[model samples]
Target: MKATTLITVLLGTGSLLGLAGCADPVPEEPVPAPIPSVTPAPMPPKTPLQASHALFDETNLRTSNTVPTGGAAFLAGLEAAGFAADTLETTTDLTSVGLKAPSIQFAALVDSTCLIGQYGPGDTGYRSVIVAPLVTGGCLVGESHR
Candidate 1:
């Protein structure tokens, strides 16, 4: 009876160990899909002043009557158009260029590029918008009346 009891206990223990081995492996925690990296959209390219220059080059520069009137207005327009306000320079005295009207000359340095604009009493709108290399200060693209 003792021998039979011992054999039964051993068989039971062996069966439990074998069952444990056969149990399904803890399903490997489903590897979470690698979170994709998010990248920001690139900014749109800056438009060159080609259109403004073309308008300036036209025979009748005053095609538009909606130009800013005074030096202050012109400077404000430049600031609104993404120009650096600190780099802006404006002067009413056109004596150096012999412009008779109470003209306003404005220049702004943007991205190491110089943009010059001229507006005055007689002109319908901005008379010129010139884009030039930084070397040429400002107002070099349009007629200076000199």
Candidate 2:
């Protein structure tokens, strides 16, 4: 063919070979190490009186069914939670004039301390507290059921 065409073909072939030899080699990626799993420790057991707080919440949540309403339900919850009837006390369901009492106060005497709780209607809600025994050596005074 022509001289210029032959020279162009030779130059193009030489450039391709030169570029191939000048390229750098690719590097390989390193493998990662494995991770270890960790476990948590267990907690110690609680006393019967200390467990009463949790039982009270459980009883309060399921009111009006499974157990009778008002003070008896709370007493049942306390009894089921390891309290004996002799150790329990509560306010009367009715006032001396025969009107319904607004709320009921109950207590479980553990040694000198009283684990006291007051349960009422939806508007009044419920509360539990740790209180000292009264002067007469009991929790409730005035009119009470036991």
Candidate 3:
């Protein structure tokens, strides 16, 4: 080929090569808005009650109890009070006791008051199991339902 023709071809190829090296121009996505920091609310204080206070009652005890009705939060408080993590059991049969221990079987009332369990059968009705502070935890000793 002629010198001029060859020079033109080389210039065209160089220009094409230079264009290929350039980055693609694309509009970037907008950055997402930053999430607001969350400050968790302080936990409420837990009140440990008597073992009898933890029993199952039909009326007053039920009102003051915090176990069955308080849901998981209440159970958590029990654990905080030293109840074992593996000991908690949920129930549906209302007549079928709610919570128990080796020495005590009881039902919750409202917040942390009423507890109804077995001392025996007849005349020996309700029994109270002592539950110390969340520090001492709950010590259960007795025969539970099979």
Candidate 4:
């Protein structure tokens, strides 16, 4: 009887050990971090004169199709933008030699800068508009007409 009881106890212990070894292990999952959001700043619009100056620079005046041709309207626009009008001259002298149409030269001085614009006769529009720093009196090249 004692042998039988010892045998039964041993069998019970072996079964428990086998069951533990055959069980599968569960792995723990990792947590993810949250991301942050950001916003950009706004910019201001350019003034009339500033816009005009930018257009002139971008187009180089010679190749631009947007610049206004010479007339009362052109002078008025410049004057309204705080530019002091000089004089309007009608001549082909200031224009490129290839263009036979007489051009009207429009000149203005604003904030120590001289703006010279040349427009062809009729509806031919602008030939060029040059911006230069003012010297002792005015722009060295675009100031006078001869």
Candidate 5:
């Protein structure tokens, strides 16, 4: 081989070996620990009044009134919340029944005990049979007994 060619071949080999020697031993990075899948706690069940609030948009029955507006506001609230308005059956005597949707029966009796209105010892001006939402199942459709 020619001298120049021989030198060129040696130089090429030297350059290749020099580049190979420059290779770094790749350091393995530490893998981050996997985060555990955290499930959130379920919400607690709502009470009758709370459930009513959630289902209805408004309540006409004033808990403090001696004679609530025949629970009109309360019934309206129930409809707003999501219950079927017609499914709720009510009477002035506080004996009301509702077809609790999805499979549940609801009955509520509004009497002196279930009265939403308040009264003083001598005050009898507002003695109404108010129809209020059932404390347990669904909407409330009621009327005034007075």
Candidate 6:
């Protein structure tokens, strides 16, 4: 409202606006570069030998103490793991005298190899072997239950 005071305020405001343009620029932080995307390589298929052992272990034959050793569950496990039913040979769960056998022998014929496996009542564990097919065009010998 006072003439001299008003002029002084205007000069101060104008001087600040003029100095603002001459001020130093603010610094900016540097940004990191983006990472490149990667595609993983596909895994190779498991060999028949590996598959046979995997099937045996996956079915829990190593620790199975009951009839599953020579029972349908064991065979079903093999079949479910891509072993054809026709390619499997197994021994009878019961002996000739109608008793549980000490152990059961089974085989899964894959390609030209037969993965022979055995599991008993107290099998510490069972490991399958990769062997050639029998002369009879099957994996097992003597009388097999299929």
Give me candidate 6's TM-score against the actual structure: 0.57
Better of 3 and 4 by lDDT: 4
The candidate, 5 or 6, that scores higher on lDDT is: 6
Model with the higher TM-score, candidate 2 or 3: 2
Taking all chains together, each candidate's TM-score versus the true structure is 0.39, 0.58, 0.22, 0.35, 0.26, 0.57
Q: State the weakest 10-residue window (summed lDDT) of model 6.
A: 60-69
**Residue 45, model 2, lDDT:** 79
State how far residue 137 of model 3 sits from its true place (Å).
24
For each candidate in the order shown, give its overall lDDT on alpha carbons.
0.58, 0.74, 0.42, 0.53, 0.42, 0.74
Q: What stretches of model 2 exceed 4 Å from their correct place?
A: 1-49, 60-68
Candidate number achieving the greatest TM-score relative to the actual structure: 2
lDDT of 4 by residue, 1-146 (tens): 99999999999999999999999877668666676665666667886557656644333343324344434445555555544456322233434656443666555554455556666645775655546655644543543432
| lDDT of candidate model 1 versus the reference | 0.58
Error of 2 at 20 (Å): 35
lDDT of 4: 0.53
Local accuracy of candidate 2 as per-residue lDDT tens digits, 94-125 = 77798987877888887677877777766876
Residue ranges of candidate 3 with Cα displaced over 4 Å: 1-27, 50-112, 117-146
Question: Model 3, range 1-146, lDDT digits (tens) per residue?
Answer: 69999999999999999998895878799899999999999886545443324322333233224434322433444445555445442222223365432223433333323232333333544344333323323222332221
C-alpha RMSD by candidate, in order: 15.8, 7.2, 15.5, 11.9, 16.5, 10.3
Top lDDT hit: 6
Query: What is the C-alpha lDDT profile of model 6 across 99-136, one tens digit per residue?
Result: 88787778878777887887765444565577889788
Higher-lDDT candidate among 1 and 5? Answer: 1
